[model samples]
Target chain A: MTHSDQISDSDQMPRSAWLCEYLARLEDEQVMAQHGDARILAPAHRLELDPEGWATAAKVAAAMGLRHAGLWADCLDDSALAAEDRAIRMQACLEHAGDYLVLETQVPMLRPVLASQASIYPGVDRLERHAHDLTGLELTSQPDGRRWTRHQAWPEDRFPLRGDFPLAGEPVGRAPADADYPFGRVQGTGVYEIPVGPVHAGIIEPGHFRFHAMGEDVLQLEERLGYVHKGIEKLAVGRDPAGLARLAGRVSGDSTVAHAWAACQAMERATDCIVPARAQALRGLMAERERVANHLGDIGAVCNDVGFAFAHLQCGRLRERWQRRSQALFGHRLMMDAVIPGGVAVDLCDKVVEELREDHAQLKSEIVPIFDVVADHPSLDDRLMTTGVLSEADARQLGCTGYVGKASGLAFDVRRDSPYAPYDGLAMDGAILAEGDVAARVRVRMAEIGNALRWMDRLLKSLPDGPICAQLPEAEAGAMGLGIIEGWRGEILSFIRFGPDGRIARYFPRDPSWFTWPALERLIHGNIVPDFPVCNKSVNGSYSGQDL
Target chain B: MFRILKKSFQTGVVTETPPDVADAEFERIGIELRRRIDVRFSRSLAIRQVDAGSCNACELEIQALNNAYHDVARFGVHFVASPRHADALLVTGPVSRHMEAALRRTWRATPSPKFVIAAGDCACTGGEFGASYASCGAVEKVIPVDAKIPGCPPSPLELLQGLLHVLRG
Candidate 1:
């Protein structure tokens, strides 16, 4: 069949109907779809399937108006898919010689060519672009042909995601030296270009935002990232599985638990290994704590950026105390290396739990007053209230997640939708609002802090006792795994493929920053250049995270 | 004010140290210059942090050193905005090809007496990213590294020690 002919016939249905039926089918199959009101899930069996069968299933999912939720193909035995077809359709290749694919195609991509899915599933715009970027697979009828992730690092002809790409260092050509990148400009009469930083005033990560403006109000903002791109994807290829988890932890310093959990989940899914229930709970606790810590810091930083130094000072104090408590309990301020492959590295002792409970109590009692001070003051709100508004529609279109999404009224949290581990056992009230402005973002942070405090209290009150980690079965060649964790930021998706003797064949971590960074550019419209710092702080897409 | 006072009370009374004892003492045999030298310190350092596509472990260590225990201000190496005013460039991770230009820009931004301290295995050489295609593999590739601090994620103390070396440089 021609490539266009491969497009399934069922792509014309309305998304609402398709989503409902998919969820119903998942429920019928005893697989539950969590927090996303629109998301659905279906499980696959352990046996190997044909490439055509896999493609057909993806086509059906696409036709049903469901994007691929990411595939987790676990190759446990030698009897996986046949070699020729496996080279193309496998979501990630395995070290154990096992096969798995986790594809997240938009509702629009399921149909045959002529009518592309990008128009319908706007959320998949960057996603499909990135997928094509990494895997070098041709996404038929993709909206734009521009290079998404490719720079001068690798051979232009060679695709890095291919199994044949060298893991060893290669001397590459210089990056695109032209000062002007493909950033769209405003069409108004008085629009001017205001280029700001791959470097900035504060100690934030490097991201250059090109603003097209008419007078004081921003007409448009386009972000050019990848300044700190380390080729983390290439580094992960052929690494030990455990090593990948450690690497995942640092994908974003503040997002350790989420990224680690996502990577670990991918590994577990591929191995078909179920972590102990308690480990799952502890992981959730860690994720929540991370979320709280970052939110606290950001709230303070936002205030500081706006010249409200008292709130900044107080928040800084609280944040410092929180980090100290974390250090006292987990041995690192940021809880680095506290999460491991099979489970967590740090487990809560009774003392640690008690200490955490004490900290939570203090935070809960004090935060309200601090936020009150923040709210009562006009200057703080004046700078924050409607500055950098990311409209609700734009949030959905850009697939903004975490506090940014919730602030903009997109109520998608992996914890609630996916319902993995401790999040399912405990309630996650992801505070959401629809204003889509800086103030709403701050409010979301405040609300999330309150919720996180509650989560900490609950976790401490009923701290689980168990072995923190488990010895994994020696991964044979071609073993594959998928990890999905709702990091403090949002969904952290890690796809791992193990080579023979348990080496990572390929590791891809989709940090939430990937989706959220673009949102920063979109949200800055109508705001003056001076307020960019506060707006950027409110969104706080990680430069390191996105670079990785 | 009352709430602050109450919080102080809740924290319990911290015994005041005597002037002579509180300060680190230095004595001459005959003339006891009892003029105690209080270690006057500043909590700010004009720090220039360099990134070499690090796993960010060393960066985390640097952040940890700034946090509670080994607070950089105790020795004074704060993360500053511009390198022109920075006392040191705390370089982290293996230098990647993409960051090479930025690293050079940052290095040139610094004024005289500026020290470049490579803060991790990756910063010292191409840590893991060294073998990979994306790596330029060390701070020396872009700038002369004054000190190399080793460890996957060097302990907060090690980072502090590296800073000390830079301060002394």
Candidate 2:
């Protein structure tokens, strides 16, 4: 598990210069030097490792302080390989400072397995399980082997991600009950367990929360999710760029604008095409609007959880009104399917832009006072202030981002640090807080909403006049691209590979919930059961996003 | 608090009348379902929602049904916590494989007069995420659906009208 000794003195360069030189030195036969190929991608460098080198490459990245971003598998063509060597391609994506490094290897299907990175990156526990369940590629030492994405839909041997596997799976009389899922237990004098939902009281996504508590205080809270998994990754294969973008938008309904934008950015990059400046601005405008809308809703929902109905009602009214504008200006309340592969589907005119500015100004006047009332309220402060504290170390270890990370002191923003297209020159200061509590999270969201509104104004005032979309040439077979965006929730990273006739070979859209959901489990320890709802509302990890 | 009190009076009944609920053409179905329900149950309806596998777009609209603008509670329609307490199950999504049994169990939990209303296009027809290895498309495929509302995520009023339609039978 430890590879630091193998790093040698040659690896002691500055962090930025280390990777390139280190990668070059890797060509020497002494260091993880299996028959592998390395290529520098626009956003990240990709290293296609031999099975022998895959684990070491991942360890190297993790040791260098690179956070695990995502992990997925791509199926290999069995026709080219001998029957015994027919394998599935495993991919591991790690993020450093701001750049990403995608490590890959091939594991034969007969006994397809790779060393688990969960030992190094505890966050990969679920992601590795997902790859195992879908692709039938097992990990050598994955600690928690309980089903992650596979919920007994397919039999043990039937892998859905395989090219030969059927989409309409053969189901015997009925799917067995998922009730017997083994939850971790606590055995003590005062410990008892409370199991809540796959069916919840409120109209929310289905997820089971098992709490091992001593009287009122929680000792542990383990979340059993994947109740909303619809096989989105398996469904994405073979879809063309436009079709893939549509699928991406539905990855999480609330994040339609951000997911589709990321997918389109990936496709545009793979095809080596640049959209017009106006198109980029339009994307920025839509993204900021989506951010403000979600934050308003979350702030309100947080208050509602604590019995502050007035703020909840006010925020709900504002969010509803805001989405109504999205419907008017973009033709859909959620702005679903508005982001196409080449560019956006709609254009903004002068009068519409002017009206939007006026509405934006009016919205500010209304929300600031509402925020003051909620912030100053003695009861709400008592409920939210110091509860559900996820320390800076926990947030960093789990790679939390968006409001969750910013609230907990992870100062990473894709818009500013890794600025794409429209955000190239935007200033993003004063949006980070380091308290790592429910109140800090709420504060971070409010501050983000404020910043987003200002960004929208700047974008609209200097709106460029040009074509909104461009003609994208068909992607070359074997072309690959990466798209990373700072979505409302946090950073959304998408990886795409093109096959014949512009079809997708593999697509993985990593939602920020991947990090924050774990942070939820960590933060809720030692808190009372009644405060669980508020803590959960604070993180607000999209079940659909995580389940996918 | 004074600001809220003043604004509350100034807003002046944002909640709509039962029959005049503005939405995506749910008025026709509302009238039809009202006729089908027994007078006893028509006075009040309780909904227990089971999200089989929805992306939660439908859940948001359903939540909005109870919001200030579209308060279904005023019309004697409210959401309950338990299926036994519920008269009908407002199901969403193209039933994910894991949730299929939970949906069936939820149905079994409800009493004999229990009904099912499939909301959202995914719930009605599976929408884009059709029958697959992970999903058994549509709510009716698992449990019988009495009423179906269709949209990517149906509007709040559409849900209101659909619930009325279900109550009729």
Candidate 3:
């Protein structure tokens, strides 16, 4: 209880002398030119810190070299929202104690300093070990206090991010099939060890890696994910922003429009709701047709896990003609709840937006000579140029976001770092690369499937018209919103809350496969064990979007 | 020239011998009917599926019987990889005790006349995670199913008409 010796908000002391007296009052208000509204809007002063004031909010975001985005742990409830300053400004600036924790940051002005960006940022060590394995909280010096998102899917003293857990898929029971699964291992001589899965051989989902080789050169790798968790944040606690956009489009069925547009932008920012600039340009043309049909079926399953069967039967016949033109334009072909709460559930019709501009102009004129027959062949560039590499400083010390940290350069892209709505008037383009291998993650997924087929032909030739949906109002109970999106496996944040009569008392989402499943065990070191299925299809990541 | 490729596969113009196994007098009923007609003419299935408390609407109609309109790998059905290279245990959902020991180690690692199917209405009962607590609702309470397929995720032509009713028995 020493972080800022507790005056409880507005000042206090010790999270390193309250981040050196709040960056010396933000460098004396940036030397008398008053640093514009003295910064503070994230997690509203992170509801006056505690839970080791998040290691004094990462030493005031590394004494200001800044650049930190996520650090989570939330359970805000005061009835969860039906409005009254959104349940009195989220139970007066986001409920701190009463259901117990808050800590989350963006840091513009010591934004409620709860800093332990994992001891001044080694990429907040697996986002503070998934907010202390789904919220029991305690992070006091965590460099790996084991249990990263607890797997045998629950019941090791039940935590599923707290607030009276039971969103109801069932099984708050059963444990002990040799119980011990806590994870850590890597010891020596031909390092030996194998494990593989929570069960595998594809039709995906369910995890558990282990590895520790010597013969295959992979000396350390450990992953043991929540085996298909399905309590989807406690059945999205009381539900209803169209049942949490059909449970965030089942969280990761190939990321249904980035989990139903980040659970309908956290139920339209906790019900101030707007949506309709032609349903945000048809939800950015169904999120660039679900990111060019999952980067042309994961660059043809990372070239059919390296045996390149004619670029896996022509990227499975161009992802089955982009899922039969998304079931002839949104009637679900993995489009799922097609973006809901206050906007979009269907409405592309103008002859399905001219058959989605003649099928993305024949998939950008047949993906440039089939990605130049997979970038000039030679056994698919000798098993994808220097195989599973990762680097840009181990993909920014493993926070590894989408297109596997934009092929390792890590530019970050919640539609260009938090823009929201029709990617704030388009132009978007972010396909960086610093050669983090597997052919720069298959040329950053074929340049993000040709920048999502030229931003879905400029969002279907400037789509516009009117109401696809717009009735929202209700959600006000205990408010608290925040969503984020981007998705084809990148940003996808979500948080939500609301309850008391508008329901959903906490929703959560997270999943950029929780920091690219620990950068696929640090990019399968010196790669071999039969090139872990083309390096796990070059970071495919979603085991039901990190087992929900 | 190899008798014009064996007279173009016996005048059928390339390949024609697949239709002779239907019941050729139950293959002369002997030695366990010729080992159940050589294990039903080398059966292929493998499957394992599991979901167990689904609304993945029969896991997208069992992933549209592996696309291309009910292909289910041209009827040999194969989705396998650990139910010990199965022969059939498809399972979808409603048996929740966190998938009852991974559906009883996917039915004691299949390797017999093994077939289970179940497919939908949350694996034949517990449908919407069947009043949750994480379900142990159906798929014949852990293993022996044989065939079920109902909807709410059932139409890849009802998962190729329930994988041809779990291959006719």
Best candidate, TM-score-wise? 2
| Order of the predicted models by DockQ, top scorer first | 2, 1, 3
Off by over 4 Å in 2: A1-15, A21-30, A33-40, A78-81, B2-13, B16-42, B167-169
Cα misplacement distance, residue A303 of candidate 3 (Å): 9.5
Ranking of models by lDDT? 2, 1, 3
* Candidate 3 per-residue lDDT over residues B69-122, each given as its tens digit: 223454455787677777777777565454467567758877786778887676
TM-score for chain B considered on its own, for each of the candidates: 0.71, 0.84, 0.31
Cα lDDT tens digits, model 3, A503-533, are 8877777777666777778888778888877
lDDT of 1 at B12: 35
DockQ of predicted candidate 2: 0.68
**Interface DockQ per candidate:** 0.31, 0.68, 0.06
Residue A271 lDDT, candidate 1, scale 0-100: 64
In Å, residue A548's CA in model 2 sits off its true spot by 1.5
lDDT of each: 0.62, 0.81, 0.62
Model 1, C-alpha of A298: deviation from truth (Å): 0.7
Fnat by candidate, in order: 0.35, 0.76, 0.13
Interface RMSD, per-candidate values to 1 decimal: 3.5, 1.3, 10.8
How many residue pairs clash in all the candidates, one count each? 45, 2, 37
